[model samples]
Target: MDLSQEEPADWWEVEALYDLCFAPGRTALSSYRLRDDVPPVAQLCLCLWDESDALAGVIRYWPIRVGGQSALLLGPVAVHPTRQGEGLAGLLIRESLKRARAAGWARVMLVGDYPYYRRFGFEKLEGVQMPPPTNPDRVLGLSLTPGAWTGVSGMVTRATPQAAGHKDATDP
Candidate 1:
């Protein structure tokens, strides 16, 4: 398997992989409502490829504000069924998070199972909130910088209009 930043054209394949792994109603979840007007933060994306170059897994991050605290929202990580249990998902997550930190992002949050994300330093977000219909227990966060999450609290929303267009990194 190969792990690296995504390539522009690989996005379509990643989207396909997501469609297959998740139900069609997946996007209707409350967390997605916040992303309606926001574009993803391109720099932190990572994709995994098999020896034949077929897309095996993918992960991406978006910029959002929790109440007023700026943070990255990681999501939509998917691995092809045929490649499950090979550690591709973890690899994509680890690499993407490394990229996120290198780019100066201090925090990240996600709506996912606590058990799986805990390995990456994500813990329940005490003061951060997601749109309705989302269970609070599943809302997790990680601080790339030590104590970065201290005092950060509020409802998470799409990034401000100004930062929406600011993108410093992209997949090769």
Candidate 2:
């Protein structure tokens, strides 16, 4: 398999892969609420392809603020059914986290199973919260910078429009 930074041109193919892996109702999840009008960190989005060039998996990260501290919200990583158990998802996770740290992001958070993400250094975020219907236990975070997650706790809100330099759907 080959790995590459996801480009805008890969949107539909990536979305299709997500749909196939997560099913059509994925958008209704609480994580999607955080991303509703937010733009993902383009450099952190990644795609993997097989030798035949078919998309094998995809991952994305969006910007959010935890108590006014800038952070990346990692999510929606999906591997093609055929690629399951081959570690494509893990590859995407590791690569994206490495890039995020290099890019100066202080922290990253995700709503996922503890056992799976623990290996990546994600720990339970005791005081951070996502919107309703999300199991709080699934909220996990990793500090890219030493002690970055320390004292970082609050309602996870969408990053300010000025920070992202673009208007969100809620903007008038």
Candidate 3:
């Protein structure tokens, strides 16, 4: 599989992949609340293509703040039905996390199953919260730098540069 950073032109294709993989109501999930009007971390947004050049998988990370500290919100990773058992999802997760660490991101969070994300070093984040209706147990985080998650707790909120000066709606 060929992996590359996602380009702007790939938006619709990526969305289609997500639609095919997830339920139609996926956008209404609490995780999508944090992504509203926030741009994804460009370098960390990735796409995977098979030898046939068909898009196989996609993953994205959004900028967010937890207790006013910068971090990333990883989510909506999807693999084509044909590539479901090929480990393409894991590839995207590992590659994107590597890039995120090298990009100087201190931490990353995601709302996902522990059984799947735990293998990537994600652990349940105590005192950290997502939007309503989300299971607190599914709120997980991984530190890229030692002690990065230490003392970080609070609601996850958009951390876009444009919102830097203003208190985030989700901030406590």
- Stretches > 4 Å off in candidate 1: 167-172
TM-score of each: 0.91, 0.93, 0.92
Query: With candidate 1 superimposed using the best TM-score fit, by how many Å does residue 114's alpha carbon deviate from the native?
Result: 0.6
Candidate 2 yields a Cα-based lDDT of 0.86
Query: By TM-score, highest first, what's the ranking?
Result: 2, 3, 1
Cα RMSD for predicted model 1: 2.6
- List model 1 lDDT by residue over 39-130, tens digit each: 67766778877899888889987788876767888888999999898888888888888888888888889999999999888899897888
- Candidate 3 matches the true fold with a TM-score of 0.92
**Runs in model 2 lying further than 4 Å from the true structure:** 166-172
Task: Write down the worst ten-residue block by lDDT for model 1.
Answer: 163-172
- The candidate maximizing TM-score is 2
What is the lDDT for 102 in model 3? 81
Ranking by lDDT: 3, 2, 1
Error of 3 at 90 (Å): 0.9
Candidates in order: C-alpha RMSD to true structure: 2.6, 3.5, 3.8
Q: After superposition, how far is residue 90 of candidate 1 from its true place, in Å?
A: 1.0
